[model samples]
Target: MTDESESMETTNDESQKPESQGRMQILDHALSQARKKIISSAKLQLFQKHLRPIHKKNPEVLKRMHMQLTKQLDCHISEEVMLMFAEEQMEKILDDLDGVIASQKDNKEEAWRPSGDPQQDSRVYNISVKVKQKAQLQHVLSQLEQQNTLLRDHVALRQKKLLGTKRTVDSGISKWREINEAATSIPADELVEFVQKYGKIHRHHTMIPWDDDIDVLVNGSQKEAMSRALESLPEYTLYRPPLVQWKFFSKNITRSKRPFAWPYIDIFFFGENETHIWDKANRYTQLYMFRKADVFPLQNKPYQGSLQPVPCNSPRVLSRTYDPTLCTTSSYTHKEERSKDPGSRKTVKCESLYRKFPFVFRETRDHYVMETVKVGDCILYQTKAALPCWTESP
Candidate 1:
């Protein structure tokens, strides 16, 4: 080859190599920043999620506020944290009050090596817990009785309230033991089976500040098809009749770092193309355009969840049309029309969630029921007691 040609080829390879290296470095840096931000932010997010009421009145109390949160119903905690706390509080905080004992009949102990102090038997890193009859331990228990009388009363009171629905969950959040039971109630094997048998079930944590239940996701095309198919299944003869329609919705933001996947189970049913079913279901759920999809799936791999319905045989399945061609709006004539101005255009974009679907298709219903779990699986699939269709949404 000629010397000039060789030089030219060498230059091209060098240039391309640097550019490729630079792009990779840039992507890596961006990913690192995002991970740091999300993991750090998750700590604070967890705190906010457990504690209800926007602001706590006193700044001074905020120091010990988290510790003393159980008795004072003035504060609140979610089920996830309550479960963690319930396991620890009795031996530490609720000392002398012989009442805070867990009556679980099962003796299944989790076996793991200890990392910290080797006083009794169990230890995990810096936290070491042991069961023994020490000398001053009795005195410390006495101090608990005197200093924290509210501990015993609070324990009994919450146990009594465990019979109700919302209260059971709320009370569980109060004692720290709630989430453990919640987690244990549903077995992991059962959950896996349900997800495998049904479509995907995403337990997503959305942008909503206060933590709710898992974000159940499902696909669009298959969702419609499955609604019709769920009818033939004989197991679905639990309470309600067969279903005909179902709806789906993504949250208001996309590409946003989510809070806690470890803490809660998000039963998501994803779809490939963005479906306007959530918008139409607003008529049924009474929700405004509160949530929106931030990102689109690569192809038709949208997440479809079991919450979408199966056997096409539930009491609640409505109708929906697919319009995946463009980001255009199909016939949507609202009674509250506005004037012809730039503001109207902006408002439409905002109301329709900025992300428009090609066709409005039609409205649908989401009447879901939990079916049986996998063999030896203890997973509890949540059924919507009632649909939150935003019909009166302004």
Candidate 2:
């Protein structure tokens, strides 16, 4: 049963969270800028600050430190690649990766360099780890495996369609159909159910609605909450898009090169203690954490009563219009997350993903207009559903 006291406490708790997030956001930005300036100011300063004589004796600690540094560098590389996006994104990616890696290597305290880490030595290992947290890394690894397997399996089928050997040679292009088919099979409903039953699902949205992008926040209160609520499934992996941001993708559909196949669940977590979710190959939805208070304004006023759960329109959707021209440049998305992989007869799953800013569940002329965003990819939309907004048309 819902405890009256617990419910009151929860209300109080939720009320305070957003304010906490705001204070923390300022502090976080300040600290991040300080770190950036410090890193850029002088390599010696950073090395001296993070390094120590005791560190030499504790090689494990030093190696760990290096691993962490390299990982941060890789995150920057991920951002650079995305900012460049699609055309020659690779050259910029390599250049940025090399630059970040090099700076990290130089700034890397000589005492803690990975030359001492026995478990990992390869560049690929370092590059991959540096880029993703532990969960995301594993997901990417699984995706890589899936990508390779699809390539080999489809090699024969793709050869005839290719005029030259090129398209057939590039597994990304050849295996997309297979990849989409695989992803599309698991219906959104199934995915939502899976998350509810077995996944760690942290859900929230932004306070102030802006015309820019949609925001869906995801943070479970404590360590156990994060672990039990967010981490049960190895089926999905966390990932970084082209350069900077992180997202989670189902391992089942990671092989597709189709932009649509870049399945991602956009999650934003609140206020510090970000350590639990930031490990390499490990994926998290948001880079910054906010407390409940920081995001309270974004919370939908419990329409009708408190028994209903949070509504599903996206933040931007609740506050904005559907201008296709503006939508193209809006830098927001509401696309299908993981396209169905070919050869699968299973139903494609979709959840009612939306934030519903100013969420008033009312009746429209004929249909109830609702704002929606896809689960993994914060893809947003505005459409009236079969449900009437009110008993009578307005």
Candidate 3:
């Protein structure tokens, strides 16, 4: 009996050993992460303190610095490195200021020294010192401004490169996939679905390139539920528009409320009836309209390596939303918030789309005709007085 009990105890001890080891490993990892967080917080505090005076003198520079810091932080860089870079910048500014101050002081002494007229000398010396300090401060501020601009450009270039990388683009798209999966928890009748929108055209052009945001369409009724669900998500923060409009409502979901929250999602709430669905007619001169069949019976479309539920007839929906010619032509995206400068716009050919789809063209000396291809057939033709427009031969 004694031998059996000892054997049982030994077996129990062996069984618990693996579990105990796992617990220790987890604990160690937690501690390490906690230490990093503490150190990062301290460094950030110190950096902010260094900028406090500069912020008081020139708030705009401080704002730009904060923006740069936000972008770098998003890149998963260590706060220690950022702090060091900031210190170097501050040091340079100080060095420039020191040199200017020294030169001004030397000049002041030579030009306005103690004279026989004490009162006059005192007034001139005070005014000179004030003017010298002002000039020195301005000079230092300009240097700092230029350095900030260069830093901003460098970080922006690095950021652009990072975003263009396949891994980063995949990661960004995966986030939308997660949101799509989470949205499925809602019932089908409520109509929560991701739509291709402008991104649909890009599918023919590029291999799921990084997009600024994703578009989601939900029934007007599901607004509250979606708001609650998105808020519950750890990765998403839902923002509702400030003003309420008839038949128009949207929720903007962002990763964070930072200065450069690039990749986000827009959830547009649509009003529906038995025959048709529409959004924001009063707000938009050309409201988006769709037949009930165009949206119902949501179909899965391949997007960014995942099969996301999209409107059944995406091309039809897009045609109604944007100019039909947009399918054949490519141009820089125009957003309401962006500057409306014609010089900034460029027209480019949808080479990928043109290649993938068949089209017939007619060329003449004065004009050309081009036909729009849909579903492997030439459907419509348009004439233009430019380089040979490809027109569908009837």
Report the number of the highest-TM-score candidate.
3
The positional error of residue 69 in candidate 2, measured at the CA in angstroms, is 88
Write model 1 residue lDDT over 1-394, tens digit each, in one string: 2235545654554454324233334434444444433333333334445654543555334435533532233223234334555676633453333233433335477756655667643334324333344446887888888868888788778877765666755543443232222323332211111122212221210111122232323343344333343323332211111232222212221322422122223222332323322322323233311122211111111122212222121112211221222122223211112233443332132224312211111233445222322212333232232222232123
Instruction: Please give each candidate's TM-score.
Output: 0.17, 0.21, 0.40
Query: Of the candidates numbered 2 and 3, which has the greater TM-score value?
Result: 3
Alpha carbon lDDT at 65, candidate 1: 53
Q: lDDT per model, in order?
A: 0.31, 0.38, 0.54
Report RMSD for candidate 1: 31.0
lDDT by residue (tens digit), candidate 3, 242-305 = 3432121123433234322333455677787798877643474246677877666665544554
lDDT of 2 at 355: 35
Residue range with the least summed lDDT across 10 consecutive positions in model 3: 383-392
lDDT of 2 by residue, 205-283 (tens): 2211222222323332332333332334555554434333345445667455543234344433323342322211124
lDDT of 2 at 108: 44
Candidate order by TM-score, decreasing, is: 3, 2, 1
Off by over 4 Å in 2: 1-215, 220-224, 239-245, 255-261, 272-394
Best by lDDT: 3
